[model samples]
Target: MGKLREVEILLNQTQKVRFERAMERLQSLSSTTNNSVIVADSIPFNHDEAFLKGHGTSLVDGELLTTVCGVVNHVDKLVYVRTLRARYKPEVGDIVLLRYSFVAQRQSRWRVDLNSTQDGLLKLSSMNMPDAVQKRNTSVDELNMRNILAEDDVVCAQVGESQRDGSLLARSNKYGKLHKGQLLKVDPYLVRRSNLHFHFIESLGIDLILVRNGFIWVGEHTQSNDPMVVDDEIISSKTRQSILRIGNAIRVLSTLGFTLTLAVIMETFDLSNMENVQIHDMLGSEFHVWSQRGKLKEEHVHSKKNVKALI
Candidate 1:
């Protein structure tokens, strides 16, 4: 109550009418809700918190309002607002990778690919750089459209503010770059915009690039102890199926929101499935079928005959 600079009971005609109706209802329910009574004319119609404080009391009008959380003594104090909040609050500000196709020196703006709708723009002047820093980078020749960034090149960036009239902005040269790795894309709808900061991979080689549209990765794969890799690549294909299949399996698990454990399962399944299949039988079948087959197709029979004559 002491927080009030002053108190008033003033009310407009409409509020007076509303107050009357509310008071009538309050007569019966106020005992249970424990709200203070409203004086008809002398007290006026006090809507602000200064005149009313609900320590253990309810308001007659509180029931009538839909959106307001009950009225309080500290209404105007701005207590609930939080500072240092992350920019993208699920509605916006998902970390996005972009490429700058155009940078305008005159307006000091960048034309960036946002992966949806039209491209986004980041203005140099709005980067909030200090004058001293600006002078230091002055030799950089402002910013040419193509010199700083060209088509097809990728950049790691953060989502910035959007205009009410429909424009998007992003920034993040200070954050980090999209280094060498494989690209992984998840369905855009599956990713909560707020979840962008939560992505992490324990492996040194694997990194996730999350965006609203999708994510791209750039990395060499680690070897998995899958027997499928040994049989498919080493014995049959003679390639590093272990690492490649592990990478693919990791990708599928990532799409399903499963973490690294799937990599182990993929390896285990490869070994388990390979034990039952006889590689000798497969090779024998292939040899018999291939050996008995004709060397040439119907169209190639004439060429085969010419070669036979030459031999």
Candidate 2:
């Protein structure tokens, strides 16, 4: 777990011991090397071979040194440090959750806050028109950009490349303005990039978008449509409860610094139901401890299976 200061205060003596043991087990299971370093620390390098320093590293005093605090990584001849607490770094093809900040007239793009250092650009050309027609965006369309996605609307989009000037280009069809949903923010590192970011829970009829930028959206499942077109279907009370339950599962996993995955989320949901724990009570200290213990037990069983297979 990254920073459990808030969680630590809520745990009792036995819970604290159990939590510590689970964290120790997790740390032992991590594949990351012991090459963690801080700023200005000289990184041991191969002097004989030419090595390229990547992000979070700098050349100083004829030695390669780290410029950020993180674990060291190596790829071929390149060495880089993966910073632990930096803002989201947009990568091409990453799914991100953003809030529409404002429309930028200079570039004819909509500025969206992605919880990153630089706001991303959702260009008029990137979005699908209201009529689902693919054509050139005229000046009239540019004028009506606000009507398509107004200021303060939260959207899900895929990262296109950075423009010449360094602004990120965002494009999407399935992703656009989100509605009738709850947006939850978590540490970006917790979200592992995978083939599918969009998940439709068939049983609950809820849509879950696990953005690479650490924004999770839980809402009633709906077909992709233009933001201007609204869905008239009403969400049932049962579906609403399911959505909240899933959202709370995400929150608990995030708080525990567990990796967010569809399997893990579904396990948490199933655990809640099996234990007869209400959605509201999932956030309680006891349930948090219990959840961690459950995870630890699962991991132990998985490790035993791996060992047996090797034997």
The Cα local distance difference test for each model comes to 0.37, 0.73
| Candidate 1 C-alpha lDDT tens digits along 1-311 | 01212458797543453344344434434455432233221112344544442232333444311112212223453212111111222224556655556664444666665555556665653332322133333535454434544565455555655643223332223332233343454434333444433233333233344455444433332243221121222222312333334345434333332222322323322432354423233223332232113121111212211111100
Give TM-scores for every candidate, taking all chains together and pairing residue i with residue i.
Answer: 0.37, 0.72
1-311 per-residue lDDT for model 2 (tens digits): 13322322586744565456445534553545567665666788878999998999999878887877667789999999877655788887777888888988665788888877777777877775668677888888888888888777778777776644324433335766788788888888777767778777776778888877878888887765565467878888999898899899988877776777776777888789899999999988777778877853323222211111100
RMSD of each: 24.3, 7.7
Give the runs in model 2 whose Cα sits over 4 Å from its true position: 1-32, 37-69, 72-81, 105-107, 163-172, 224-228, 296-311
- Measured with C-alpha atoms, the lDDT of residue 201 in candidate 2 is 74
lDDT of model 2 at position 202: 72
lDDT score of model 1? Answer: 0.37
- By summed lDDT, the worst window of 10 consecutive residues in model 1 runs over 302-311
Residue 166 lDDT (model 2):
29
Give lDDT for model 2.
0.73
Clashing pairs in 2: none
* Highest-scoring model, TM-score: 2
